[model samples]
Target chain A: MAEGTTDVPIAGYSAPRPRAHGSALHRMARRRSTTALLMCVPLFALLAGFVVYPFFYSIYLSTLNRDMTRFIGLFNYQYLLSSNTFHLVIFQSCLFAITAVFLKALIGFILAHVMHNITGPDQKLWRGVLLLPWVIPPALSTLGWWWMIEGSYSAVNWLLQQVGIHPIAFLSSTAWARFWIIMVNVWFGTPFFMIMYLATLKSVPDQLYEAAAIDGATGWQKIRFISFPMLKNIISITTLFSLIVTFANFDIVQILTAGAPANTTHVFATYAFQVGINSGNIPMGSAVSLFMFPILAVFAIFILRGVTRRTREAI
Target chain B: MSSATLAAGAAAPRRGRRPSIARERRWALWTSYIALAIFAVGFLIPPYFELVTSLKTSQEIGAGTDPWFTQHLFFGNYTSIIHNPQFQIFFLNSVKLTIVVVCVTMVISVLAAYALARMRFFGSQMFATGVFLTYLVPESLLFIPLFKELANLHLINNTWALAFVWPTLSVPFCTWILIGYFGSIPKELDEAAMIDGASHLQMLWKIFIPVAMPGIIAATIFAFTVCWGDFLYPLAFLFTSKQMVLTAGIVSTLIHGDVLDWGHIMAANILASAPPILIYAFLMDYYIAGLTAGATKG
Candidate 1:
């Protein structure tokens, strides 16, 4: 794309007086670069101040002691490494992120295919309804989940009782809390995956599917051969994106469990807040949060590779 | 029949095969409707139930009476929440912060997106990728350091703190979406403007901005929703009742320790989510377009 744009100006300039055009082109290039730099000033400044600077600062903070008065290199890491709560948080965070991402991706893929199979106004209406979970704020939506699952006014339990079953404690127990946390994460995130996959599904040209049908391909076979391969890039990118966000998730877990029932439900973000802010162990919290960095870095690299590869294929 | 005869018979009269195919399609369609209905009901029930619960009396809610419906209508939950001074502060704070952050994000994003999409400069590709990387850098990772950074700047507990911090979340994705939007415009339009000696700024202001209004609107909606819904940042930075935004404020204040107010809490949730929900209702297409474009295109 950049080559095509640059070619246009050069082709136009080639017809003009050669010597004059050369200097003019150089001047134009200089002017264009200046404009680009000037245009990017605000963004660079904002990223620098908020994103880049804070990122490095977090690394710095993680090295410091609890109060951050003195640098205690690797002490926070050493302490967190051996701590059982931090270990549980690591286990829980991985379990929550992976399970939620997998469930969301699977549910979203099925929902998108369902939406695709339906037609017209029905599809539009269902799409809108399905997106409600994603549209609402996580903090707010999780409150509704909390209310439904809370022991005092347990709506789900009430229904279970109606069915002549025992009312289970949803959030009061460790396993139940973790179960609800992942459930809520899947609920909130599936719509995003659905919308993304739906868009990708739309872009899969009808000709491919028609050709498949002509060859006597089954619905499952069409999806396997045509849909999955076509959607591989998008699926990976969205899953990785969700994985990173879920791995560092704070809102759903915090609002629902707040790492309750013995902190079995704590992920990196919630645990970081608990240790850093609530406990006033800033360095430890920073360390806890930074634990997400290496995993996310790996995911980020994979997503970037997928994005660039897809773009290259498109080109 | 023999296989050749069966094939010949199948090919001879397409009309004869129509009813069975139609029947199969009808069955498939009915099955899809059932599946979709079940999925939609499951998805919508929680929020719908919250809405219902919010409209019920506290006594009814506490009694766990009819989790699906209420006998008596009650406006007290909504009224009490709206009338509460603290809740009002949370609402106003959210509004103020969302507006400021959205404006800042759109400006920064538009300028950056324009540069990256239209201008050929050194390191532009790297910078564009950097923006995406920054977007992926979750606030959970940065909040601890940001807390210290804001403290050093004395911006903690100040609502304006978010105005500075939220762009880290909003700008990268907004810029990415806008880049896709801007890139989609035919190059000739901008190239023609350039040949006519239109400056880059004028071209951006007059041509790109006008043609890319949909994308800009999409980005604006995205930025607005993100700013409105963000939890981790405000949760970390703003501690005071006066400082808190709607999400953190309502959660912190309403659901005190062990004593839970189901009606008021649900009402607060509905109220807090109202802005984004209303926006999504009106601009659903733009919201989804921006999101998909950002995810798929980038």
Candidate 2:
């Protein structure tokens, strides 16, 4: 035995060393090419056992009617397409996603710029405080929103009343309900935009700004020519990712309203859970949920390819 | 750091006769500040309003005691909910499920990420990308099938159902993150260990696991947070009130049908959210790194 080495291996009788055993494990472990695949088994087993199987199973389940008895291909999809309930949910989902994404991006950008400009000693503290909504779980925060917007005890409504304005039914009325959901989403998601923009902003060469400043560039000119262009890719990537997330969002909607005020607030996700899980009509719910996948898949493809491209470029 | 430099940069200039451009920039700065303050208020008010409501009793809360005005802080709600067995079970279920899922996710993701990062075998890249894109498919799309499969396995309504199903969402993102983190680790460390007659598994257990501890921690936080906060999967799977995780338990059972129990509901919501909130407060850097790793690497 070498100095500082012992006959007792660290793993210690877990298995005979592959080299000593002269088995396939040795061949697999010694070769880098083979090692990767061998290592992949545990992870791949997880995916195969859980993700892929469930995914394909859901697709198959949707084709069948309730109770998994008879194959009724296209019936579930066609029904979902033709139903008035489905149309309303789909429209609400798009409205929710679009409104949330735009507000989050706009507000996040403006905040990031403000934080960048301020000469405060406690900048990190401000950023952290601003990030509170994101850090706290949505279920909690949104539940809080649910309480605050209580039809009778609504703080917002009371405040409006004090100002001589009519008390709006935030959670009870369809229009006010929709507005509040979008508003909550912007609160939760803007941190992501802020973080990404701030990170990208840190890397912008100060020289570009200095040169532009020297050339008598106004603040708007500096932002347009220097800052915004540099942030374009980060902006695009962040917005695209947020869109997919907000589109399929179940948490905010579920907690805030549970597709309430006569199901006017139903997104595809909540609608699926409502009809499928809550109501116990599994196939129809599966059909409703699958509606968001294809649209999201396109977004995923762009993101994956973009990541690969960035990695290759960096290398 | 930058701010000090900026202030110094401004002060170092001539004392008298501030330029027209500088005055114009100050105007822009103030305007931006106003816009930012208004936007921040939009972001800040609703949740702050909720906090105030949660602290008020039903009577005081309903008495319309000036919604914005702080009156009679009701911390008893927290204690009341904490004393409830149902709320306690929900908390324990959530904590238990999050822990087990995070462990399983780290194990699966580390091994898979190691393969995707270090292995150059055929189709590895494609497989890696596929895993992440699978993750991108919303939980809604998969939960129905997952519920059915779990039901077939007789795991439905079991809190451990999350021990089975959460990895469907978690593993992909976790794997994506670990691959990015692992890819950044130098191959020399593993190669040196391998050349010394160590098996790949040994290298992973002794060398890579230690070296990749930060990445592992990052992935663990991500896994835990995702599992902890999930409402949809738990709602879809768990049946009995006792088995319900925090998110679904509060959403479904606490609210009940047609009768909203505001006191218990708010208290349960606050209690259930405590872990993730604390985790985020401490490990913000790791949290952001884990999120962006999934986004950037996927």
Q: Relative to the unseen true structure, what is the C-alpha lDDT of residue B131 in candidate 1, on a scale of 0 to 100?
A: 88
lDDT, candidate 1, at A294: 93
TM-score versus the correct structure, for each prediction: 0.94, 0.88
Say which docking band candidate 2 falls in.
acceptable
Put down candidate 1 lDDT per residue, B61-149, tens digits, no spaces. 76757798889779899999899898999999989888888989988898889999988699998999998888888889889989989
Per-residue alpha-carbon lDDT of candidate 2 for residues B26-75, written as tens digits (9 for 90 to 100): 77677766765676676677656656656767676556578665566788
The residue-level lDDT of candidate 2 at B269 comes to 69
Give native contacts recovered, as a fraction, per prediction: 0.76, 0.58
Q: What tens digits encode model 1's per-residue C-alpha lDDT throughout A184-233?
A: 98989999999999999998998897666555566799889999999999
Name the best candidate (by TM-score).
1
Name the best candidate (by DockQ): 1
Total backbone clashes of model 2? 0
